[model samples]
Target: MNTTPGTRWDVIVVGAGAGGMSTAIFAARNGARVLVIDAAPEEGGALHLATGQLSAAGTRLQRSKGIEDTPESHLADIVRISKDTADRELVWLAVSNAAATIDWLLDDLAMPVLPEHPVRGQNHEHYSQDRYYWGPDLGRSILAAVRAPFRELIDSGAVTARFGTEVVGLVQDPEAQGGRVTGVVTADGEEHHGTNVVLATGGYNADPALFEKMNGVPAYADASYRFARGAGHRLGVDAGGYTRNHDLYLCSFGSVLEHDDFPAPVLCRPVHWPEMRMPWEIYVNVEGRRFVAEDEPSVDVREHALLRQTDLRRYIVFDGRMLREAPPMIPGWSADDVRAHAGRHPMFHVADDLRTLAASAGIDPDNLVATVEEYNANRDGEDPLGRRFRPLPLAEAPFYAIRVQGMSITSTAGLAVDAGLRVVRPDGTAVPGLYALGELLGSGAFMGNSFCGGMLATPAMTFGRLLGTGILSW
Candidate 1:
């Protein structure tokens, strides 16, 4: 579909990712003329890099497998994992419609999820039931599923997609009309008028300035899509929409960075799963105190524990004997790589003594020595942090420490939206014609301070489908 310069559209969606595509497809299927504008050179914004993990309860796949599940169960799991900080109404909406979203992909779009999927997820906190899902090609598989129908809609002249176009600002009605959104203005100064505008511009994880502004902490790693610079966030703010959820910022535990640079690109992530590799290294904070059990089973506990530390940074401490004898601490790295990178890499350090090792890693020397001594002394008894698997002592010479920091793959803060997906002001008044879906509304909206599996992408796709199907009145 081609767009004429001044033609009015029924819906204008910014960002051509999972949520934006879903919104355009559903809206067009409902007989609306939809125009989608994205800043990327091509569509599939973050999906190209996303893991595409999703979760839903009581879907046809679950039923066929005889797996007992329900939306109520899904809602309960998310609230429990999020510690009740998640917006209840938004969680309810996402979970309620999640099954339908998954079914649409599987049954309608004929997308193939792994046959043995719907399992408890491994990366984040595990759901009680087997509700997690992913495709063989990760996020690209999900994009293929959405893009097929979306292209069909485009060919039918119901949806028009313009890539390499950025929505710089939203057009709003007069102050007399409560400043309702009217359309959007592109970076090229072209104004596109529409009855409804959906901001699916994703998150600001890629922008260090906005990441620190919204999250109250500096971004530690550059792991998100580069185009996710929070354009929709700015557009929503310009249209009188407020943002929230800064207090709910959460970070993943460990990522090996390419260098010592702040917001450094990730080289590889370390595998800290106890089941995969038994405890050989202990994690210590800047104060040189053990913050969490080295072999803690729950990833959520480890991540939350890291949040309380200074700057959300920690060091993995191990001695030469353990480094040589224990299973590889960093995933995909040979034991030789660990030894080689220790003294050479900016993120890794090694010294002949405990105090020297502590000094090299910016840890308090006295406290680090005491912490290591305490662990060595308690080898036969229950560990102070209740660490059950104390396989080796850190008494060997030539100690090593690998600096690690908390990092997030998604932005936690975003434009505030009501239950109907309408962007709202700080005073709680809706900005008519402006709706937000997906990461533009923030992962904190549904996932809270915890990393809830499938909450981000699932809700983005679900709300996009709902909004396109006329769930909100224009």
Candidate 2:
């Protein structure tokens, strides 16, 4: 099922995701023959599952909304969120190009943001203005918009898309002077040569074993792109690029995964922590004790606390009152849906008593019972430790508990690159003809220490645009 047989090109992009497509488009449009290859049957990598939140400063959208922002402000926000651990120059590059790149995506690429969007902030945090936006299906909208342009390129023979093809290794011309990569070898032993190769393959979150090896934390997440096995990293390192940012592995909480597969579906979504879903429910750590404010205002605050816990596992304890009074906490689930899965949802372990519920949920029976009793007693504001956020207590129950684990959808650790998006070796020599975009460069590189706005999608697009139109030109 080769889309283009025996086709050589000026540039070969090793993915069909956002960054890969952007590179191919710009390269082809600039009179360079480009070949796009991907392991997926179609375009769009993690974009299909992404929330598509992006933050940009000094854009037309910001001006329209009467919001004051600049590239400096954007850089400040990214640095603050990353606690100054982010690379200053790289962050500047991504932030500076955000507005223009986004504009290009919306105009030429047909990207549309969410309707009530450009919100100051939503799931992540306040970005200082109404610049955040995503389409109805989030990442899917961005993917759809970009796909048509690439299709035109494919039809014109300027871009060759080879889907269901894996790059087993990179091809280097040692005798061709200065060790420049010539092309890549696909899994089926096909060598498609090109002048430049762009590695847009995503992160390694889907491969737990590899992720755990890179980052010290165990890969408890079940929500990353399956094909993001760090194939690009191996090829990059094999060709002399150095990997960095393996220290900043982060996780998200409030998910009740039923099993251990990567990218596992949420069996029960807890809206209690971020107050996105009200804290009509209380959370207990594996020790059967309340660890957080329950209804914390900042997602970072909650995520930080969850990271300290064992294996990122926690249980949600809610009473009949919350079940009846609060809005359906889980996104996409109605109260009726909760009722239908009353005894069936694996996380929805219910019992007549606190001890019984603890046993069913694999929690310490006595510790859980004491924790509940203590919480109930403190409902009157008698305690001083500042543990209860609502002080509503969990007394009125057909006591129910659900087990949840913290997981991630993108790679946080990656190779360290210069502001020019060049892959640098250990001795600090820039590897010519080698460039990395998207998750292969690592999520922490752009978004910093946290998911600051839409750093993942935005940086990939921004860099791809920068390289396609400028870097690869000379």
Candidate 3:
């Protein structure tokens, strides 16, 4: 749909991802005329690549399995995982409405969720209850569910979606009106007026420069949606919204990249979870010292440990014996493929001894040898770093090292918003007619300093639904 210049909309949503679509659909259903603008050729921003993982308590799916859960329990789990760093009121809002949002998708939109879902998630830290869920097709499935009803609204003229339209600036009222947002100006130099504006343009992980600037660390891999360039952040700031949670930046472990260069695209993420597959090698930092337990049960601990390493990088040190006997370190990689990549891949190094392997992998040679020797000597006793699983020793010839870097899939800092999802200034006053949700609020707002299962996507949808369904005055 084409957005005519000077057209007045009840709500102007600056993105077409999960958050914006939810806002548009619900607002249209509520008899509000909505306009959704996106810079991409299509809608469904990060949802195209998102895992679509979501968690909620008191859902019918959980009840069907006789799993007793509550919003309180969900809040508790997130607070515990985030170490009380998450915004309590905002988290309460998300958790309390999460089940309703899921039900809206399942019963109203006919979204397909896995039959045996609400399982305890395996990727991030595990929640105490089985409230995690995802569709077989991942984010696409969730997007499809939202898209169907959204398209119906568009067809009926309740909503107008303009793809390839980028919102360049937010139109703010004069100082007498507290500088409230009036509408938005697009990159095409068209002004569209609206009663309220919602920013859902996702995160900044795809923009290496912005990612490094915001998080104060280099983005090792480019693995997020390409359009996530922090447009919402910049626009919100221009309209006097204060950003927060910059210090909450954290990275996840186990991403194998296509190259050793900065901002390299991820080739694949190896399954390093001990429960899924016991580790057959030791993980060492640049100084060749063991950091976390190779078989650490908690993914959160392992990820944080990796963050403390030099340059947030580590080397998975193993030997020829491990290559032959243990499970393949790279999931789905064949033995021949592993052998081929050992010397051929830029991230992989193979040498006849620990010293040579360290040299090739840029690790301290003496420290690498000493670390391996200590592990070999302690095979009969408790291992350092509290490692419980030591399946093999690096005693065999042809020691190998695979370089891995800690990386993030989302931006941690973002525009600050209140419990009502209204963008706020540095003094904690609300910016009238302005709202923010999704990754525009930053992964740190909900997930805090850690990765809470299903925190990001679910809250984005919940806040969008709330804003669209009369949470904001027209």
Candidate 4:
């Protein structure tokens, strides 16, 4: 493409996810001209599908509850969860600004939290204090608060938003003194130029090839925003940014996929946590044997164990008796719904006998039989291998199996950046005028190696606001 006349703006944010939109709002509000671009027709990227869990520390609620949590405690929790693998400085920055960020959302951004108010942790883990909350509709609620402000800025001509234009490449000002990025070239050969660019394009969870190359593991599922395709990541790399935290890539626990396309998991209703689904059901690997405690308290512990196992494919096997007696494992499902779910979904496989079920599902029949027998025999014992929840024996006939695969919607590995959110190269030099936030910066930065409640949505909102309003303030 020919070098077009470089257009100038104070900030150009790539991708219209929570991060990009949040940044655009702040940047525009801060008396700066901003343009937000996304490949999709709509602005909310993966927010449509996300559960929208957010975490913060030292909030109004926390203070009212008399809960003592410093930014250091928040950082400590993240580091401990990540086993000291995350960027400490960035973690500190995020945790330190968390309360102010949340306050901004609640007061100025029109964010509305649930009535429960400041629950420590309901869906994921417990924070040191009660400072976690989600909007009524989760992703939609946050988007509702953010979208209008962004659109208002665009309407007033302070912020320009161009959707359906995918950023294809980064344009560096070679003749410029600093290695500044002058513009971004779209797929359709249009160049949207700016003085500073924020890469809020989200992660590579949708691109298996890029994910495998960067993360060193096969992209388990195409579960994120398809447009997110790591456009920002590729652009960052092209502009000489170095990626890190690839080793920290982690997968969500037990998704029973419906088809090749991901986010397509038949049921992703957090079957493992809270030990909510009765443990009469045992998870078996391709070898047809139980490996770890089915009801382990930590999703991370179960996930790490699954990664160590062969194929990372497991079958949840439960007897008819338990199926009839226990509460529906899946939400909004009657027993008939559960029965139909087995045959209707691709991941779900069923059979009348253990032998036939194993053969049909491609698991070893003998091993499955042994596993079931061992589980049944030792279930009542003081201590049983692979038994943490004191689940009933799997002795009834007509056993059922649902195939669960490890998957992740957020990319954990991402471009390395400093506390300022500037894209940094491997040599530790800043990629001038380039910044990254949200999933494009990877979840590993905030959540660490663990999925600590609201790291995904919250940090994106926080960092995007901070970068646009705070760091980039001139």
Candidate 5:
């Protein structure tokens, strides 16, 4: 393939985060002159706001620990966890090539996991095998790990990066094969031509309007990477690529948002994992009804139950006694500290009685009183929701309610792509010279309606490695 005249880059990668950096690094190493561009002042994309959990089977660390695993088993878990809703072909592609990607991170990149890693993480549905891993520093560790190699490439001039630069449009030829994407035009009105253009822009979680438009739910938490505002999604759609998996949107039980706003920053995450801590409090929806069993063991069950609620929100309701007698509901904040915030914070509401408490927290007052009455009456016996951990009742006075909103940091809808990861048309034909990786591919493609451990980050880098190694050609 002959290089285009006046085209300064072999591959122009937009969004210099995990997938983009990995692509640029390996593409440059493979002898392609790479150009990296990002809207943010620096790279690291979602990793800055991510937990950076990585899942892989048959990695060097697993082998060292005598833990035998395979992509087949990993895929089996994903299918089981996602209820067979995930895209099989794309998932297989990522899983089959995942081990080498993890090995590269742990061995070649010198990134180390926690001492007792490879555990079935508790946040999401646990994978059957112990294959999930992350470093102590979480997302930042991955940032540090990938940045070293990317920095080396940057210093060597094999890769050229422009920070604070946004790719406004992709230069395409309608006459070419399937709207061939030849280059990208930056916001500054400068065209940077390349043989290939990769859209690795993260997700739409930070954009409330786009989040509601895409997922059919208002973005409740502004916890995603700030730069993830659907630039990649719009770009891909404009380039003749379609987005899919819109129906696979799923949210966690929730987090304590800082304000009553539609989209607010997360103040603190609740330790709602029953495995980590059993519930002494009850969760009531806006209808003031106990929807799911508070002591539900399956995280998936809890998440789905919350999904059916009115606003993907739940109020953690408890009595003053539950606060004093039970384990601390919210970590770092004790009973006294919790009392300090009651009636002061918008999220934390307190009342002398159940009706007042409900009204204060925007709950149905009469329904809340009835719900609490029913809950207290069935404290020692069988619960309607089949909740097993009913150690105490919501009878104590000065009732409290802390509002928690269910939200997702990753966008569920993403650009449609073929197994080779080329952004594809609705007819499943690849758009020439256009490829998409990472969250731009949507978490739904990997985990479907469920959040599988490490599926997002692992596959992002793995697909990047695959494309850089051999998939992409000039």
Candidate 6:
């Protein structure tokens, strides 16, 4: 059975992602009469593709593991990690409610986290507290955990979900302040009226043009959910709510692409984490000059260095001996597999000499040879970049180079919202019935110019819980 086209609802959620599902679930449980519409064929938006990491302080699991943590500590760590660039009000709101969100998943929903979860940090910078958490299956595990409860609400006729349907526009009441968004317009030319509209539509990373427009860089890697195409951004901005934090855009460290394109599929992710595997390779830009120290501990420092490079590209140079002697650069593949990929793939180049290798990999050959010479000269002495781990110099034949591109899979710019999550104007007046959450609020709103561990997924659900529980009213 379909919901009547013009029927009124207490809350109309635009995208059925983590945030949207949470809002619909809680609102329906609270007897709010919710409607969830998504462009995907089923629910679970970015969670289907995200890392599924969650960070919260002071959870029951933490206490059980003798981990003493608090929301204040979490907030302080985020502030410190993000360099005080994150939206303080929004970050505070998420951290304060994050523990409850995690508890609801663990205790109420029985979602299983890793046995040694609540780790200090993983790939990114370390948080002061052991608050980062994720499941065995990553994001999919969280998707499975939320699906059952949300489906129950749908089955009980409390919440209605319309999948594979896109929200084309927002219905605004011209007579109200800031043209109050009263409902949403679907692609089928139907208007679903509601008291409040929540724009949980993910981000614009999948849309290359939009991503570049917002981030000042091309979407180099095709690693985001395909349906996140800025529908919410359009709806919110059209409804008079402006987007913010575009200036806070930051790229990921680096990943090898399958092909040379504006937005290419990610072929493989090299393990650049020094803590996990010490680097036996040197990273250089297209100009064949070393930018950041290869042993740079901070992921943020390496990522920002890549951001400064032309086309956000880096070339990881090493030798055959390093492939066999050092830990596998990629998690699983071994020395033989690395040799197979070198000449076969465009991103990977192998040659007998540095000049020839640089030519194949599109790096400056003269600069490459000179850079290697300088690097090898400093092998027994102090390094120029202050690199601590200088195990071996690049003297072996069959030299290799892996070209990696730095890119962000999440949007940095998002629609502006006030304390209540209501989409607001520049003057600070709320668009009466409009609310925005999830990636539509942008990653920068929570993580700022840096990638704070689990900030995206955790805050998304926390905001949804906050919005659905006693925030929206008929």
What C-alpha lDDT values do all the predictions have?
Answer: 0.89, 0.77, 0.88, 0.77, 0.90, 0.90
Candidate 6 per-residue C-alpha lDDT over 351-458 given as tens digits, one digit per residue, 9 for 90 to 100: 999999999999999999999999999988888988889899999999999998888888999999987898988888888898999989998999999999998888
Off by over 4 Å in 4: 1-7, 260-265, 268-270, 343-345, 386-388, 472-474
Global lDDT of model 2 = 0.77
Residue 64 displacement in candidate 3 (angstroms): 1.6
lDDT of 2 by residue, 1-474 (tens): 233566567778998888898888888888888888899888888887887777777777667767777889878877777777777777788888889977776666667876565777776756665667778778888888888888989998888888998988988876665578878899998787777788899888777787888877767656666688988888889888878887777777657777655446656555654545557677888889878877677787787788888778888887776677777777788766766665686667877788888888878889898888887777777543354456366877687777888777688888766777767788887666777888888877776567677888888888888888875333
Angstrom error at residue 7, model 2: 6.5
Lowest summed lDDT over 10 consecutive residues: which window, candidate 1? 1-10
Give the poorly placed runs of model 6, Cα more than 4 Å off: 1-6, 471-474
Q: What stretches of model 1 exceed 4 Å from their correct place?
A: 1-6
Poorest 10 consecutive residues by lDDT, candidate 3 = 1-10
Tell me the tens digit of each residue's lDDT in model 4 across 156-197: 888888888888888898667557887788888878778888
Q: What's model 3's overall lDDT?
A: 0.88
* Candidate 4 CA-lDDT value: 0.77
Clashing pairs in 1: none
Shift in Å, residue 370, candidate 6:
1.1
Which runs in model 5 stand beyond 4 Å of their true positions? Answer: 1-5, 472-474
Q: In angstroms, give how far residue 48 of model 1 lies from its true place.
A: 1.1
Residue-wise lDDT of candidate 5 within 1-474, one digit each (tens)?
213356568788999888998898889999988889999999899998788899999888899999999999999999999999999998999898899998999899888789998897759999888899998889988999999999999998888889999988999999987688988888887888887888999898888999999999999888889999999999999998899999999999899999978789988887898988999999999999999999899999999999999999899999988888998777787899889989999999999998889888999999999999899898888899999988888887889999999989899999998887888888888899999999999999999999999999999898888778766443
lDDT of 1: 0.89
Q: Give the clashing pairs for model 2.
A: 53-454, 114-134, 222-263, 222-264, 223-263, 271-277
Quick one: RMSD of model 4?
A: 2.3
Selected candidate, larger TM-score, 1 vs 6 = 6
- RMSD to truth, every model: 1.8, 2.5, 1.5, 2.3, 2.0, 1.5
lDDT of 1 at 80: 91
